[model samples]
Target chain A: MIQDIVTVFIKEFKEILQMRGTKRSGWINILVVIGVMGVYMPLMSGREWVTNLLNPISFAWLPFFLVIGVVADSFAGERERHTLETLLASRLPDASILLGKIAAGVVYSLGIGITSLLIGGVVANLGSLEEGFVYYPLDFLGILWALSLLLALLMASLGTLVSLRASSVRQASQTLSLSMLVFWVGIFLVTRFLPEEARVLLSGFFTPERLPMFVAMVVLGLVVADAVLISVAMLRFKRSRLILD
Target chain B: MNDVIVTQSLTRDFKTVRAVDHLTFQVPYGTVFGFLGPNGAGKTTTIRLLLGLLEPTGGTAHVLGFNSQSEGHRIREQTGALLEHPGLYERLSALDNLDFYGRVYHLPAIQRRSRIQELLEHLGLWERRHEPLAGWSRGMKQKVAIARALLHRPKLIFLDEPTAGLDPVAAVELRNDLAQLAEAEKVTVFLTTHNLSEAERLCGLVAIIRAGKLVAFGSPETLRSRRKNERVEIYGQGLEQSLLPWLDTHFGVRQAGLVNGHLELEWPGDRELSSLVRALVERGVGVEEVRRNKASLEEVFLDLVVDGDKEPYTA
Candidate 1:
């Protein structure tokens, strides 16, 4: 079983990275950050611009996975492409399929997470005029990275389930995008509540804050949730229904 | 005991639609079983059930002597499948994709490498091994799909229109490969397709499905023998429509339809085609040409779908 899952993961890994859309999105996102900070760097001497420049690592990771419309559509896209039926019929197990998809999404999502964090670091140091020239707080990077992985977990599984359930690629992606609304909203609520004193601490949750304890907690939570959702998705996968039509 | 796949009233329904209606069929080892149905006729659905990709809403299926729906994990280890319009990560190379799935089968890394090399070479994918799949042509991608299906050396393979999008040559190549695999590896194949000619050529036994229901199941020749009427094509410039009743009653044809002034008749058989020509000549109808259809798979499919519960073909 472990071998089956790893096989799928490795394959899905290469497949997703080379995805044209993801490659293009990575570059586009990089340029967008450069352009935004290009303006922020010169203006950082102003205090008003400082907070806006450094505040939300929340939305940073969000936009990267937005390309996961491709990821979200992975399963349905296979069916649309006529590959899902073949894949399910293959010697590869269904759990392996689900894991491969999640692995792909995680790896791809990680790219956006890291890139955004890198830019977040650059911008924080340059300081939008508001910082009067400041260095980006490393805490922001931590928060954004961790948040991205957490978000990737729930998001990828949800995408898999939706892809499995929908009849067409368009319908599957549309449904997946809707579920993302909840995640984005969660970001909104969490970011709004960040107190200045707690920014570094809360952001610790985002970054690899030595919260070895916190890390353990997150891992424990994810393992439990991942196992539950995986079994649920496995149970839900209806190969007959997918290929019948 | 040799049966590799079996279904007992296996059914799948979606809300109000019956996708596979009580489908019960099986294939013994060493046979190329063909499953025939029109598009949307539940052929693919049945394949999914056999593989345990989809759970049956009712009934049950056994694959490799295991309960397909519940013991799917075990069943997967021994089966290979090539479903319609199969997919792969466009970003990976042909070789990498195969190697990756090879791992899913848990082939040791050394063995996996050899296996990938073996299969890729066999599939003619060796030259394009390193190119990312995103850039491969449709045919190339399909070959990759085939390689993926056979990577594990599975005991039973389910090919649901495996040749669906291939060029004629590739389709033929795949069929030959499947045959070779069956003979040499002793693989049991459960194939489904809408292409009657392909089915006729490769399938040992054929099952016909219509509107999600099994309409006919038998050896290809058996079904062919069951075709009710001997259809003789008639070509002439002016065979008056007025001669129909006379032809039907005199020739013992139960019913007939005309296309472009050609008469299509369903009736009792004749020992000779010249006899139908003589009958036409007596009515002053020019019998331009007469030929026996020999009961094609298409005819069998049409009989099941369009005929509905209509009168059986007598001849």
Candidate 2:
């Protein structure tokens, strides 16, 4: 089963790279993504990017969007291109196929996320020669890595569930985009349009003395959501059901 | 034990429609078994069931001695399928497409490379292996798909309409290649195609289904011979269209028509040819030539599918 999952992972990774038709075009896409997240964003933020924990946290969700962009096509694209049935007909077990896809999305997004951060580090140092070489605080770096992985997995699992039922890639993408939009908008509304006293009360709940507990609670919530979505995806990824679809 | 596939009254229903109804047959080892049917006659549905991709609503199917419903992965591990579509990745090169499947089947790196090369070379696709499948012609992509199906050297393969949309020349070419590979690999093939000519040329045994029921099952020769009709082509002068009705009535002719200015007649095999000729001569029809024509598989298929004959035969 491990071998099967690895095989599928390699195949999926190769597909992600070749998704743009030509190797050159695929490379161009990679460069564009890396240039924006790794270069342009870091250049704009300057030296504060590495020293400032809030600055990196603001961009930590980059991997989440990255995963969402590709995960919607995990199953829907295969069906749209007439490859899903054949893939499902293979010898690989259900768990292997599902895990392979999730792993592909997670790894791709996290790989890009980490690479961008590393490049940002170097850029930050170069731009601020007087500050000598600098890096993200070790503890903060750990938190950022964990946050990126959880977010990537969250989106990958949720996108896969949506893709399995979607008849086309366009439909899956639309559904995923709508869900993300609603989530972000809900957050925006709560933060921007809330009554002032209610907002003060909410902010007060996260006093500096309780900050650690609040962070731990949010992490636990993310972990629970990731586990539930992944479990649902595995249960739904049956050959009989997918073949009929 | 001699059969690689055995289904006992295998059945499937889609809502109000019964896609496969009481399908029962056996495909022996190392033979090309043809599943012939028209559109919506359950050809694809049956293939899906055999591959263990779908569950049967009734009865059972044992492919390679593994139950299709409970042991599907085991069956899939031993067999390969090229379903209704070619199922190749259009964005990837032909080599990449085969390589991916090779990995899925767990061929070692060296063996995968060699096998991919061997199949592509045999199909005359080795020279253009680097081009993405999207840029290749429909026939070429189909050839690559066939190559992928055969890559792992399985004991059996299921091919559903492998040459569905190709032009005549390409279709014939694919058919020839398929025959050669099946023979060389010695793999049992369960092929589903509506092309009776293809079935006649490749399959040693075939089953015809219509409206989710088995209409007939036999060798092409046996099916053709089962029809009680003796067809004759008569080239003569003065064989007018008016004589068609008389010939149909007097000689027990089931069908008689003037085709391309010649008289063609079909009647029961029990009818005598000499008497018919004598009557034609007496009627002042100059009989220059007379020839008997054997019924083709296409004719037998047409009779069974169109006539709705539900009897099943095995030879």
Candidate 3:
């Protein structure tokens, strides 16, 4: 059993790393992320990027949106290329399949996310202005890092679950693409519409309340949810239904 | 005795529809077991049940003497599968695909390379080893699927419609390889196919299924020799169904029918064909086609599946 699970783990990890267009797109996503963070340092970190340096000339911006747009395809893209079926049928048990898929998502999403943070870190240290650029605070970057893992984990698990139940890759892909809509909607409900108390409750899902509690809950939730989803999938997966069609 | 695969009234249902209805069959070691059935006859479902891909609604199945439910991973290691579309990773090269699955089965990294090479050569996929399966032709992809199934050198194979998409040439070649594998390696093949010709040509024992029930199970010759009609078709001109009527009256040409542009009859072997033809001709009926009524495997297959199959009410 241990061998089987490890085999599933390593194999799925390779798939996450080597999935179609993943390496190339992953490279581009990494670069774009670096570029966005390189450009966003002045504005977001209000330290040496003081009010005096504010000018259209300083606006080497407008490209950060592109990073999110490009990285959006990573999870849904596997479904499009017809690799999901093979993934589902592997000797790896159902939960392992789900875990590996999520792990791949994290690698792509977090690799890009952290690379962006690092590039932003470099820009903060080497900016033209005299003020410090890590002005968002160490705690802020940590929150972003922790939240990025949570977001990637949620998306990956959701993508795989949808992938299994869908009739085709296109259908599975829709779940991933439209999920951003849910993300934006949740953001709006919490920030713009929800009462202050309600926002605090929902903020717990996105950004952890305390550092330790936040890290523990998101990591714990992802692990526990992954286990539950896999068990459910094993009970639900019917090879005849998937293969015959 | 140690049975490779055994099922005791195994049943699986899709909602109210019984996909494998109280199925019972044993696949002994070292035999090419062909699963014969028409479209939607639950052949694939039965294979899934035995492989532990789907839980049985009732009854039980054992593979390699281990309970299917709890010991699925153990069964999977010893058993291989070749399903439709094969579900290969199109992004990976043919060699990588097989190697990946070999690793899944836990072949050591050192032994994995040789095993994959041996499988690729055996399946005639050596040239395309480096090519991604996505770019290969249908036949090529199928060969890779076969290679992956054999990568771990499994004890038993559950092959669902193994030759469904192959051209006649490839199909025949693969069928020959499967036969040799069965004969030489002493490996058991659990094959599911609707192609009667393929089954008749290759299988050690053929089991015909219909609507989740086992209608017929035995060696081809035994079923052919032991069915109700026992009919044979003799090809020739000057043969008339009316002329055969005399034979029906005199020599027991039970329920004579003309098919394949020839005279057919459920003939009894008591009277020799020479005398029967002479007697018919002497009676003023023409006897140009005077061949012995040897039943073809195809006729027997159709009889078991379509004609002689019991009524739904009875089923």
Query: Top TM-score: which candidate number?
Result: 2
Q: What would the per-residue lDDT of candidate 1 be over residues A51-137, giving only the tens digit for each residue?
A: 454445454555346545546666777767666765666666667678777777776666655554455445554534454555445
DockQ of candidate 2 compared with the true complex:
0.82
lDDT tens digits by residue: candidate 2, B1-315? 999999999999999999999998888999899899889999999999988999999999999999999999999999988998989888888998898899899999999999999999999999999888887888888889889889999999999999899999999999999999999999999999978899999999889888888878877788888877868999989978899878867876758899998988886787678998899999999999998988888887787787774344444
C-alpha lDDT of residue A96 in model 1: 69
For candidate 3, list the clashing residue pairs, or say none.
A48-A131
The TM-scores, one per candidate, come to: 0.71, 0.97, 0.79
Order by DockQ, highest first: 2, 1, 3
Real contacts retained, model 2: 0.84
Worst 10 residues of 1 chain B by lDDT: B306-315
Q: Which ten residues in a row have the lowest lDDT in candidate 2 chain A?
A: A51-60
Which 10-residue span in candidate 2 chain B carries the lowest summed lDDT? B306-315
lDDT of 2 at B49: 91
Q: Give candidate 3 regions above 4 Å deviation.
A: A1-91, A123-144, A176-179, A194-245, B228-266, B269-275, B284-289, B309-315
Judged by DockQ cut-offs, the docking class of candidate 1 is acceptable
Q: If both were scored by TM-score, which would come out higher, candidate 1 or candidate 2?
A: 2
Going through the candidates in order, the fraction of native interface contacts each one reproduces equals 0.82, 0.84, 0.33
